[model samples]
Target: MVLPVGRSFYVTTDYGRVKGFRYAADNGRPDAPVVVVQGGISGTGQLWRLDGSGWWQSLYDAFAETEDLQVISFDYLGGLGGSTTPEQPLTVEQHALAYLQALEKLGVDRIHGWVGGSFGGVLGLQAASLKQGPPIDRLTVIGAAHKPSIQSSLLRSFQQLLLQNCDCEQQGVVLARALAMLSYRNADEFERRFEHPDDALEYLLAQGERLLQRHGKQANKLFTHLTPILNDYHIDVRQITCPVQLVSFSSDTIAPPALVSELEALLPDCDSYVSIETPFGHDGFIKNVADYQTSLSQYLPQLAETHV
Candidate 1:
């Protein structure tokens, strides 16, 4: 099946608004199950592209081949994408509200699944816990927990300090991103890929430079605004009534398997908890797609017969 072109739309929220995208199912079933997908803090609604440049292109490709499933995603407020820049940072609950508003605007009264990774996974938990808005039947959270880990928080706090104190803010952003790249992947990956220390340094710097080039001015503010919110996050897993599927990377220090296991135990109804073994660490969700794609495919179709 060919990937559908995404149609962009605007969603107005209480705090602000954001741009959203919808990928209609090729099966053209009006009663097709709708799935909402979200990525990390830097992620946008453009999950698939004809040129194969989408951030989640591999995952989206797998979804596109699935029968009778429509997909939607959105940019966060104050994000690099075509979203409103807020004066103050929005909390996780506020971000969830914005996502709910987007769904309502798109006439999505109920969702079959909510697939999110990293910060996006946190947003999914908050959204599913909401008392109002459409009910999500199933939730698939990858590499995220109800709260940020202590180490992850500390790292981000340092990044915030760098952004706040540095004279050259762009350089600060670059440096912060470089530091983040370290946490995103594990030592095993570095050991296998880089023959020397200089090679690893070059790779990290290049990753930071690439982000700076892609997002430009938005990079600094977006990093400063959204990065700290992870620290402020605290959710009652019992509130999320939907059956949850939790995926964690074995090497992920940011959102480790232990954190996801805790979440699984607290969730009202946990369908499954999968820990994919990969060296990619926190980035395994995107980097090691083949490893976890089967897990997602198995879970997504479990309730398909009940959706329509």
Candidate 2:
């Protein structure tokens, strides 16, 4: 089922006003459950574009085909897409508050589910912990932990440092993104795909160059602001009261299985923990959805029944 054009809206957040998008389900049930979907820091509310350029197209397609649900997504403050760029970076808690405000503006009293990956996952955890928003009945976090791992923090810190001191800001963005690509995927995948060292380097450079071409200077600002926030991110899992489903990749160095396990142990009502083996590492959430789609469907039974 092709999703209809998304309706854009504005919401007043603590830092400033931001843009949001709503994809009304084809079933058009007034009482249909609303599911909030989000991606990484660079991700936008446009989960799927007709041009096939969306960041979460695969997962969004799976959700969009489920006739019983509505989907909402938003851009982060100071990040790419239609959201306002804040004078200063916002915290995870602030982002979560803004997400709730966006839902409130849309008259969403309750969320059937909140599905997020990477930075979005941590945002979901922070949102579920907040006491003053509409209740989130279920939370699904993929490739993220309650806090950034020390190794991930160190890698990101270097990226920020490169951005701060490089001769050309654009080059800095390119180099940082290239460096990030290395961490996003595991060495096994790199070795398997790039038999020659030059091939691997070319692949990383191409990925970075593509990002710059796609988002321009906005990519730099996004990395500059969001990277530091992610490096320092931490959430108290005990505060979250909703049923939570955690998904992790075995080879994910950024948000490894160990870190996710820590979060699972702390969550007040963790419904399940799923760790899928994939050489793609942290990026497996997007790259190898079929590997864990069944596990994910267990949390969303409606999606399971319909998708099958």
Candidate 3:
């Protein structure tokens, strides 16, 4: 049996140490390093869990099992089960700081590529621009944008408002889940998928549970802090020195195609950006994995190529 790579934990510039697992073939070769940035507002170490049917592992499975690559990722401080919590207001910059710390502590000098979607994509662009930390050879940002729309910000604020108004601490789970499902989904996708649903009650209940799962219970206050912050979260997409490949979809109303184009123009070293022909909506990363994989196959190798 092929042995899976060993997993481990590391400390950060915060309250508690983070837990993470890596996957790489044990042949003495230096693994073609890469990182997978998760977009969930809550914790998603499960995405990398090889034990169960994890989403990330499933995505990586598309590549060669023996493909040597270091997969390093972690839960954000404010994320569901991340080891630490920020005492102060959480900002996009602060979250990026935590992610950069993880890459550094892991001894990853540079990543061959970075796969980011939504929030993670925004952070990736910021990381590449500073041209600091690890040398990011390639950038793949999907369902992302250079700025947050006023509606997006207000939507997040409403979530915090709901959480703050509630008297119970358990309400955090509800707020987190609700926001997660709503944000996780591309609004346009919903209209398309639910038009002919048979069990309206079950679907509505699912949405409810996705949000109010732990109502009346204590929740991480970071959710409250982050809600309003999303409104102010915007990144200047130009400073990156490596090639960038953006994936835009027709149905992604949140990060519209136009915004993607505008952001693409800001990249200093971008190789190219493509808009996919899919009705998969904004959350296409999870919905349309094959389309992204096909694109990555072309993008990653080029970034890894030695020009000299």
TM-score of 3: 0.81
Q: For residues 1-308, write the lDDT of model 3, one tens digit per residue.
A: 11233355656664345655555555624445565555545434545454744545545544444345556566656555545556666677766666666777777787777777776777777777765677887888887877875556666767677666878645544554455456545555556777654553356446646444442222454466445566786686766678888888776656778888888888776676778766666667666777766666667763233211
Estimate, for each residue in 14-87, the C-alpha lDDT of model 1 and write its tens digit: 77878988787555565567889999988889988888888688786457666566788998888878889889
lDDT of 2 by residue, 1-308 (tens): 33645677888877778898777765566567788889988788888776776768777556656777678889888888889888888888888998898787778899888889998899999999887678998999999999999889988988988888999999899989998888899999988998899999999989889999999989987786788899776788898888999999999999999999999899989999888999999898898777767777768765776767
Model 3: CA > 4 A from native: 1-6, 14-16, 26-32, 55-58, 167-176, 183-192, 195-222, 277-279, 302-308
Query: Each model's number of backbone clashes?
Result: 0, 0, 7
Evaluate model 1: give its TM-score.
Answer: 0.94
For model 2, the local distance difference test gives 0.84
Runs in model 2 with CA error above 4 Å? 1-4, 301-308
Model 2 — which ten-residue stretch has the worst lDDT?
A: 1-10
> What's the ranking of the predictions by TM-score, best on top?
2, 1, 3
Clashing pairs for predicted structure model 2, backbone only: none
lDDT of the structure predicted as candidate 3: 0.62
Q: Give the TM-scores of the predictions, in the order they appear.
A: 0.94, 0.95, 0.81
